[model samples]
Target chain A: MEKFDKLTGIAAPLDLINVDTDMIIPKQFLKTIKRSGLGVNLFDEMRYDDDRNEIPDFVLNKPQYRDAQIIVAGDNFGCGSSREHAPWAIKDFGISCVIAPSFADIFYNNCFKNGILPIALPQEQINVLMKDAQKGSNARMEIDLEAQTITTSDGEVFTFDVDAFKKHCLMNGLDDIGLTMEKAASIDTFEAAAAQSRPWV
Target chain B: MSPKTLYDKIWDAHVAHEAEDGTCLLYIDRHLVHEVTSPQAFEGLRMAGRKVHAPDKTIAVPDHNVPTTLDRANAATMTEDSRIQVEALDKNAKDFGIHYYPVSDVRQGIVHIVGPEQGWTLPGMTVVCGDSHTATHGAFGSLAHGIGTSEVEHVLATQTLIQRKGKNMKVEITGKLAPGVTAKDITLSVIGKTGTAGGTGYVIEYCGEAIRDLSMEGRMTVCNMAIEGGARAGLIAPDEKTFAYVMGRPHAPKGAQWEAAMNWWKTLYSDDDAHWDKVVTIKGEDIAPVVTWGTSPEDVLPITANVPAADSFTGGKVDAAKRSLEYMGLTAGMPLSDIKIDTVFIGSCTNGRIEDLRAAAAILKGKKIKDGMRAMVVPGSGLVRAQAEEEGLADIFIEAGFEWRMAGCSMCLAMNPDQLAPGERCAATSNRNFEGRQGRGGRTHLMSPAMAAAAAVTGHLTDVRDLM
Candidate 1:
């Protein structure tokens, strides 16, 4: 629920397509009802070897990408299995924004819910950003959530489209429930009218 | 005047009020719950000291955390942590007087499957769940979708939800589907071509002759991928086939009520003059048994097609495809048939129905899984598992060197102990083949159940048509 104005972070290039829910947090981690602490084991199988040691070759383990808050990934990121935990883990891991050529349907919405900005850029635009991310951990990308634009270190600017309603939502941190509560006065009025008409209350 | 489409009919019927911000307050008819996302919602409810407004409208099941084995007593003890999670759901549901189908119950399975089979998902209803596959219930011509945990709690307390309006997308599949092609193939083809995000912000209505001919189960398969294709939901008109499928179920209407229900259901279709915000038509013949060659569902090609060359796509997609190929340990221009697999998985909500099992078993009859290929068959539901066994499919799978296991979301999400070792490549019937979808660093190739069976027998991605 943290308000987003401007976010600046290192780009972690996951680069994998269909990084599904199971791989995001794994079903084993779902055992804990708590959504917190999953960031540590995000992509556990790839993050750790059989001996539970960090797999140095994994993108997340590289010293440079370890602190990445922006993830520049390939197409159809977050595909397979509809588990919201995938977004929860990604958000918990400090990834505030995900730039991809595309993303799975459910995961894309779930990202908005968890306050993670998922940007769907064209393949060419994503390639430029991915290369900027791979330039090393320090290659910073700046996202102005208020302006709805993402700028790479090389000064390439991309304006992605978001639903006007969803844009209003991210700006005000209003989810479905939050939006409903915003109509408290009207809801109260309707309830009062119904109670008077039906005498049910 | 706009003619009524099924999407509009359902949406209008469920709209309680239009709020100032243009969002609608929808009356939820059914709310399905599972272990993974309900705990926090339950905790929130208790913190607020609220009781469920409509307990009968809600149902819970344990799926994601349950182990897929008949030795439930042993499987129950496998994960102490998930056991506590399931127990919490059970306790919360009991306290709220909400109906819950626990793991030990024969009726327990994925909530989406159990809801429709039990008639909880009837036409003219609005269903919501904490899981995205909630869209699967839209097969019954309902406005169904997934919500977050906070929204889950809100629905539990009020039996109403606030939802943004979605644009209507009519995806019409004209002409007949070729013999041997199924609804799964049609949906996979659409999703693969559109990319996973193609349907975002849209309510996809499956129309035209091909969709109309599909059975309820087949329709469910199509709707299940609505989420994958980025649609809020996918719906099919409730015709006689739909009415017949729901008529005698436990929760469906009976006697005179049934007649009234049919009248309403009949009117849920799009009128001949109805228009949609977007319309797309695909010839049924253009679809084939698809397989994911890269990390995304969109990274797919026909079973007979070669891995795409780098120059085949526009923009930088060629490089992206090339990178995916490298990570998947595949080479461009290689025949998909030549790629070997280490495992074959034939289950998930996508293709875990009885028909899918029959399709795979038909191919595996008298055929043995190739040496060094580990294969397993996990049914989507206990009922599916039982039916497969009664038909002796289990014995065939066992005899063919395949593991016939009990039903849960096993290996579908690589949760629990059912996961491929690192570096393993599997031909999977379930949706998605993202990097390590099966396990850490595990590679997955998405295919049909019959195709997975074919791969099991060949130790490579062989065309299922060859087996046919």
Candidate 2:
């Protein structure tokens, strides 16, 4: 888990709705057990042509947006498939925060576990950010996790909401497995009672 | 006190601990694992110096990366990438002491299908898997949903998941389904009305007379697409059909334990006064055989309708509709039935049961599919494949010029050797129609098995009723 207190970086705009996990990291790249080396294939089909050449019109392939650390996207981003590879690819590509009008449940939960911030703003707010993000390298936005605000390059500020526990974990780089281990006693108690009552399970 | 819904009862039963912030530590009763998602999770566990807390409670199967060809011994027919993934699952399962169903095992199948088949997904349990369709097990009155790889590792090492409660929703299907309509139509129709985001924060409990009338397999089909409807899970109350489906299976309880399990499962339904944050009512008679015309599952319409113009859509959907039409190479206002297809696929966690095979076979009996078009029927699992063969459904499909292939989610996501070529439009029975889901630049029109069979015979998207 990487700590995410604040970040000021270039923002890339993905102007599409219902951008699914299949588009983020296609099924072909899912063969590896390791999470690394997927950044090259993030949005593989959309970013490349049949000859394996980069499609220059894609925003990430543009000179200024290559190192974008934030993505301003459309409604219901990451809607299909419960692949953690979506966020793994997004993080591996150096993007830590995704601002969307809404997100699917599984993908939203996955982002927090991987130290990425998924902020859900109203459509009007997203519209504003989406417009600002088209400025390419000039679209620098400051994301402050503690203040819960995103400041655009032109000084427009927008506030967003996140679950408090998730915010706590992201800010501190907390390891969730270790935290769950701290409650081993409660889990042990539940297991003993459950095994005695419903032994078939 | 407020009456508890079916979801509330299951949630309460699984809470190992609750924080002051209302965060819950949920005890998972069954963890279904598959090759594609577990490799990374297993590697994470090994790197962290952790041991599986409850190996006996977890089950692993090789499905996603498996070749559907009959020569599956030692993964001989698979690509190098697919073979390594399947082999990784075998090694990880052995090293962690979890139950592994290799490709050669007769019981090996899609994780969701195999769980219920082996009676691992019994009623009144909490089920989690690394795949989105884990909601398929909710048909048995269990609280089931998908988890990310990180959560997979969490469940493996702790057998507990950190969680929060979801809102309760009821999708009550009223009246009787008209002839030619099936459970797949009901799910597709529901998604059309719900717009893919309607059930986002809720665990929908599907009920009413129509739902109660469905068999266990039908119930599973409807619940399998709960993810496509934007819900974490969907469930049906356990009935005699459910009990009959689970009794005497390898993992089901025996004798007195069975009786005890029955008593508890009987109580796993919503109370008469259960609270609901949202309720969607759809007439079963109104739901005709349906198909998705666009990349999103919500971009669907009844097969009797025509393609919709982008301008006819409201809100942000207008842009999405335009993009979808361009990607599909379809024109607005064209009759859906007039759109020809290059291929037909009939298998997925959504509609790969024996009943699905039977429905497709009934349509294809004594009739050959239109010439020069490719078609295949990949059963959900080996047992499903075997049962289809025993029932002569496989013979009918073969006689009708359709490929009778091995199981393991073939062409559903195109992870295996089976796939569509670029620009090849297909009439598929899989759940999602997302862009490049089947293959890069490929197009998919999602439909029921009977409808897919009709398309194969007609060389276009023909309504199933016409064939019947």
Candidate 3:
């Protein structure tokens, strides 16, 4: 996991709604256990042609957005499948942030574990960010996790809320397993007591 | 002490540890695994030098990527990469001392189907799987939800998941379902009323006369689509129907133990005066056979309704609606049945049970599939396939010009060769209607198995009641 406090980078606009995990990283690319190298297959069906050539019309395929580090997308961004590979693909592709009007629950949590910031803002603010993102590589967006704010190149700012524990974990580069291990004694005690009280379970 | 909802009772019983920030470690009683998601988790375990702490509690099956063709009876003949994934699970399970049902096994099927059928998913247990439809187990009065690969690894290594509890919601459906309407219709109707994201952050409990009257199979069908409605899980209190279904399965407790288990399961329901964070009620009589007109599950309307115009929607959904109409190749105000389809699919975790197949067989007995339209039926499990064949349901399907497929999640997500060609439209009995879920540019109209059977014989989405 990578530590996060702030980032300023070019944001690409993906204006589609309900961008499902299947569309993010299709099942064909999910066979491998390794999370690395999936950056190439992100949106495999839409980004590449039958011959494996890049489709020039797709948002990420455009010259200016090829190396984008952020994405401004539509609502319910990661709607299907509980595959964590979706976040791995996005992060492996150099995308550190995803700004949407709203996000599906699992995907939103998965983003935090993988060091990707999934920011949910009101539709009006998302509309402003979407336009700012369409300005291509010239317009860099700044995200300050410490201050819970996203700032555009043209001086517009949007504030967002994140769970306190999640914010702390992102700032400290900690994950669920790591956090759980911190309280290993309590878990062990609870399990031992449960064994005695609910032996049949 | 405050009165506890069914969800609160389950949550309280499963907590292994709680942190100051409201995070708690919930112990999982059962963990179901499939090919697509577990390989990475197994790899993570290997990398971390950890072994499965409780292998007996976990079960694995390779259903997603395995081919359902009768010729390739085994997973050995699948695509190279797919074969590797299947074989990886087999090897990993053996190495970790976990039970696995490979494609060659007669017991093999979708993880969600196999678990309940084998009786590993019991009432009062907490089940977790890597597949979204894991909520299917919740029908047996369990707390179940899909977890990510990282969490899968954590559970395998620790037998517990770190999480915050979800809000409790009760969706009560009263009145009797109209003729030809099934549990699938009731669920679709709920999703239509509440948008796809409506149940987010909540664990929904399905209650009332309609829900209690449903068979165990029908209850599974309803709970299976809980994820589609954005709910963490959906549950039904265990009853006589649930116990009857779990009584004599392979993994179920026997004799004296069974009696003990039954008594415990009987107490899993909520009290009459229990409180919930949200309570929603719908009349079963009002729900009709449904078809999805757009990309999301929420973009649905009754089969009798016409396609909605984009301008009919407000907020940020107008653009989404317009795009969905374009992508679906549909026009505003056109009747749903007027949309022609090239194929019909009658299988998924949602509607591939014995009763579902029986319903379809009843409709297709003397009818033939429409000319130039392809139709297929894939049973939920090998057990279901064999039972259908014994009842001569498969014969009716084959006699009606529909291909009778061997078990593995045939065309649900199209991880294998079974899929629709681009631009092909289908009337499917699957849960999702998302873009490219079946295949790129492949249009899907979600319906009941009976409706799918009717569509196969009509070449379009038709209300099952019309044929009945």
Each candidate: chain B TM-score: 0.96, 0.99, 0.98
Q: Which residue runs does candidate 2 get wrong by more than 4 Å?
A: none
**TM-score to true structure, per model:** 0.87, 0.99, 0.97
Report lDDT (CA) for all predictions.
0.80, 0.92, 0.88
Please give, for residues B60-94, the per-residue lDDT of candidate 1 as tens digits.
88887677765765744457877788789889889
Task: State the lDDT at A63 in candidate 1.
Answer: 95
Q: Is the docking of candidate 1 incorrect, acceptable, medium or high quality?
A: acceptable
TM-score of chain A of 2: 0.97
Residue range A1-201, candidate 3, lDDT tens digits: 799899999999999787889889887687785778899989888898878899999999999999999999998888888989999999999999999988888888889888999999988899999999999999999999999999999988889999888899898898677666677787678778866655555
Candidate of highest lDDT: 2
Report the C-alpha lDDT of model 2 over A112-188, residue by residue, as the tens digit: 98889999999999999988888889768999999999999899999989889989999999989999999999999
- Write down the DockQ of candidate 3: 0.60
Q: What is the C-alpha RMSD of each candidate to the true structure, in Å?
A: 4.0, 1.0, 1.7
Scored by DockQ, the top model is: 2
Fnat, model by model in order, equals 0.37, 0.78, 0.50
TM-score of 2: 0.99
> CAPRI band of model 2?
high
Q: Give the CA lDDT, 0 to 100, for residue B50 in model 2.
A: 95
Worst 10 residues of 1 chain B by lDDT: B69-78
Q: For model 3, report the TM-score of its A chain.
A: 0.97
In what order do the candidates fall by TM-score, top score first? 2, 3, 1
